[model samples]
Target: MTASTANAQRFREFKMPDVGEGLTEAEILKWYVKPGDTVTDGQVVCEVETAKAAVELPIPYDGVVHELNFGEGVTVDVGTVIISVDTDPGAGPAAAPAAQQAPQQAAAAETEDAEPQGRQAVLVGYGAAPSSTKRRARKPQAAVPAQPEPASAALQAELNGRAAPAPAAAPAVTPAAPAAAPVAPVANGTGAGSAGRPLAKPPVRKLARDLGIDLAAIAPTGPDGIITREDVHAAAAPAAAPSPAVPAEATGPVSAPAAAPEPGLVDVAARERRVPVKGVRKATAQAMVHSAFTAPHVTEFITVDVTRTMKLVQELKQDPDMAGLRVNPLLLVAKAFLVAIKRHPEVNASWDEARQEIVYKDYVNLGIAAATPRGLIVPNIKDAGVKTLPRLAAELGELVATAREGKTSPAAMSGGTVTITNVGVFGVDTGTPILNPGESAILAFGAVKLQPWVHKGKVKARQVTTLALSFDHRLIDGELGSKLLADIAAVLERPKRLITWG
Candidate 1:
């Protein structure tokens, strides 16, 4: 039976449930199924990207997809219905196996008043029953019945060189509703039409808007005849689409775009781009500003002969214990820093203004500043003091890899008491490193190059590098900072100092 025919209560719409444990919000990365597509329970339905990771969400109901309540790239909080499903009548609560009834009982408790009670099949990850959370008073509104388009019909037409219908406007849903209401389906395209939908993922959709591209006009050439981003670029080449146009009145420029057909219809390319300052960069900026103003910074540099450290690195690389690791000078520098922090705990402390106390940590969480393609990110290793030299090197390698992939979680970037930025990797000698917001000290490691230096009162070629220490003078006085630098240098000058001093 058609969804419109079952208007009163025959069909069920399964909203997108909370997939991640205790997760409240997620960005719809991609929708794998459309209205009218058939899917079984456990079938991968959509991909959601939280602040944490990109996860593939599976279908909880074994039925035909009735509607997509949410669009891709939109951030919807937990319990928001992403799609609706029409379940088979025979698959009732009475028929579910006893072993599968556990989550249903929990679901009933959580979604007591909200979810339809006594439903049989539990969503794979979502609770077995509807939510029990009491909802606030809702405004008077009529529920939208489903449309008549057959499942996969419009999608199939798009793949067969026939133009798909223009997508209809989404329904006005109460943001507090369990699931979003699906937008009206567009009319099927006739004849050979050039119009098509964009092929990029949801995040890519946002990127295109920032870059200015219309999805409909872009032709499909990607897998499954989807319109790839490259297609959008080709279509947008002639007329550069600017940033998505915001309502002038809302932006305090109500007088702008007066001649346009409609505010939404305005050319995006003609609009200026504005980015919201949030996330890691915003946090970094605020912390840096606070540290720069509150803590008086003092920087000192020391040029050291590390001919022995370089030789040790080469020997460690060939050793069985350090096999398959990326052994380099930075690893030794990090180890040395840990040793120095032990001798001078003041460098691994923060000056708490409100508390009027200097907070010193007994353990070290080492932050490694890495410059990724996205931006500058410093994801740190937790409990670096506990790990062996080779183990620390491996952890450092993994940290760098995670940051590069933009997969660094907020937790990994937090609780760092000290930081080390290897400017040498970028072929630089040294830099006055900025102290990570809370911490009092940062160490910069320069490139190790063969230079003429005095070794044991004799002129000799040695592997030398420069170390720059930037400390918060309020916590670490010049004397303590200098001593810390000397300790680190002492370790690098002779690798045995780590065992002796540490």
Candidate 2:
């Protein structure tokens, strides 16, 4: 083969793109296709969990899968090549002569191993991977010795530089002891380890190590008989048995009482549970800390009768225009907040620290705080200020469902100009919610309760609820904050204002 032909790039490398805004890395949760599988453009090849959310990446070009640069559960940095595809599958047999097939094949393998060079344009949000293709030459393999014993067969295969065989089928004969179960070979064809390491992700291995549980000892329940996190935790829990015999010194009167065990050492299996904070939880934490410390927050609270708002919610539920849609107190409260923002647009803005400017947003990207199994996330409705009541309700419902399913995209959660967090769902009365990062304000809606109150010189029952508005003091002074809160209360108190003022 000519040097130019060998230098031609036959394989297309798919780098790990920045799936989310400013995200540096993502963990490869799963791979849809293995090496040699056919893939088409726009096919979701893998699922990745970034700091913001779990996203599925689609391949942009059709090709045959040549290699997966990284294994599942590995956190790969943005711009790093994760997979490669053979764009010209037929070129191998057509270009290489029969006599030089072996040499051509070896050279092709080296080319595949080299790092990709030059920027290949990818999908939006992903710029391009770094450019520099270079690889080290591999040393030649040693010859295998003849007639090796069964016990030393694996060793001899490694010495001969043969790839390790796939893990053997589950043994019919069980080990005499549970902890003596044999380890499986590495799944990706790497040579077997001397100690027979088990097939498990790095995180799972770390978990087993931290919990002091042996992976081989635990019965595997995962796919391909791999050990899972649950298996490790279960093994760590001691089986029920009789208590150990106490020393005679404990029974003696002069003996000092046994000191309490350290918190970590006492009932480690049942009493302690450790969960690593990553992905959404980690991002939320960092943003909250930055917002709390950087923004001087001032929260103001006021209690108002929302009976009219609740009645209007029921009316809207029965309205023909609102049929088949979700109508609740939140719907009206959100409308009220939007209207209030319309009245006080200054509250809907962000402080630009670098520019040393108070940037006011004319458009409203209203964020609604949601609590999902993963963590707290705030996804917003874009251009909510112009959306009709029905449109706003629909967007709110979709946003909520997506957040609950832990599928809220980074784009949906970003660009929020103002936010509303309803704490009433958990039966909480009120809370001083911190401002979401970049946004100037967050309105906390508390639980609405029926209470007695003086109305027009007569005692009457009313639906009373408290609203807490938290804002950045640098942008919103007390007077402006108070006016925005009062405007929201007035709209909820008199539901007709939605049509009149809005």
Candidate 3:
């Protein structure tokens, strides 16, 4: 069963790994290397987008990349071999195709029969997870020829009993067995049609709907004949070709159908752009849905005059202690929030639904909502209760910069007990921000605008802003929620409370 017998001497396979947090799969966002490219051990071969974040994957061993198993934009399973590297490139030319595949098959078989091994070699900062990445279960069923299927299709194959590898799909095939002749399987024999209902998961099905591509027409590269996002995209490319093909519509910008437009009908599909939901955006959507439904949320809004807080921000900017630091109203706002949390520590807690009890936390990992190119992510400033003003400002700057560049680690985004979302950055009045899952409260800081205010019993123009606090009603009631919001407003109104209340 050892691979060193023949082709194994030259070729070594690298499989996709669970990045962290029990992520089962990742999409091959981009490939940094190609076939015959020389690579060193620990060289980053490609970037992958998992449900949590975008992670760059490095090859665990040194070699020349013999082949790339999947194309870009394909979602691959955790244990699928992504790239095959020829470890002994110095030995002139490698073996034939059949010779190369034999050792790969043998090594794959060996892996299935092998015992649990050491921690998978992924990038640092991810915790060690239970690695049960065996592909043995699908050997008898899927038997794919090194093609990686979408993770969703793999899940369907696992739960819905084993399905046969579907026949190569026609670019214009439909589910009802229409007059369209099945085209030969394109690329990797993944899109061939079978004599049965086209097998595509709900999301892929929706993607087909959005693109106006028929599932039966796609060449499914997924295991057990599951159609994937790549297949849908592939089918769309040809459907837009100038050749006379029929029975399929398209919503993509490249779409050009054979038929003429109606006299007065607007082609809405032509103007629409459908981005498939996956990765960070997909994870964020699911988290928001879970939080919105599971947590009893109550949002309270307050308008506060923060003329003094704004003045203190300028004073702190010139102070020698605050020199070389990001001195802004947000720094004081965050500091005031921490001070308020210190006064009303109960706000920094969560509802343990399983235990039916309130869990009070002594330390606060404050979450800051950041919008990145990938999606909305809340990477937190850990242990903000203890960091000084300068230290807090430094960490906040690092966190924001990292998130904007899409380099924030998964560990940095977790373990938050409270959150602050500065909506004012977008120049809005205020908004009812949703609570981050598992966190009890979220404070929305609005834009500081100059408005007429009754100060010292007389109406005058003052720097005023609105604050909205959203809390878990199960733990923080109306009174506690009001007090927390009021305390934050009070500290902002009187900048000296940072010393007295803090």
Deviation of model 3 at 378, angstroms: 0.2
Query: Among these predicted structures, which one has the highest TM-score?
Result: 3
* Candidate 1: tens digits of C-alpha lDDT, residues 1-502: 6434444243555555665445577767788999778889899988776543446788867877766766776666677666767676444432232223443453343334444322222323333223223343355445554442532334334334443343456666654444443221111221111122323444435545755865553445653234445665665565645434433322333344446466567677658766544334555677678778878899999999899899999899899989889898889999999998888776778888898999988889999998754356777899897789988999999998888776676668778888999999878999888888788889999999999998889999999999999999989998999999999999999998888987
CA displacement after TM-score superposition, residue 377 of candidate 1 (Å):
2.2
Q: Rank the candidates by lDDT, best first.
A: 3, 2, 1
Find the number of clashing residue pairs for candidate 3: 12
- Clashing residue pairs, candidate 2? none
Off by over 4 Å in 3: 1-6, 94-234, 237-262
Kindly list the per-residue Cα lDDT of model 3 for residues 1-502, writing each as its tens digit.
Answer: 4434566656777889988678888888999998989999889999998877788888987878888877787787788778888888788875644424432442343334333332221111222233345333422332224333444343333333443233344344234422332122211233322223455554466568877987755557775355777778777874454433222222112344469777998988778777788889999999999999999999999999999999998998898987788888888989999999998998889888888999999999999999989999998988999998889999998888888888787788889999999999999999999999999999999999999999999999999999999999998999988998899999999989988887
> Which of the two candidates, 2 or 3, achieves a greater TM-score against the reference?
3
Which stretch of 10 consecutive residues in model 3 shows the poorest summed lDDT? 118-127
Q: What's each prediction's TM-score?
A: 0.56, 0.67, 0.72
- Candidate 3 local Cα displacement, residue 63, angstroms: 2.1
Q: What lDDT does each candidate get? A: 0.69, 0.75, 0.76
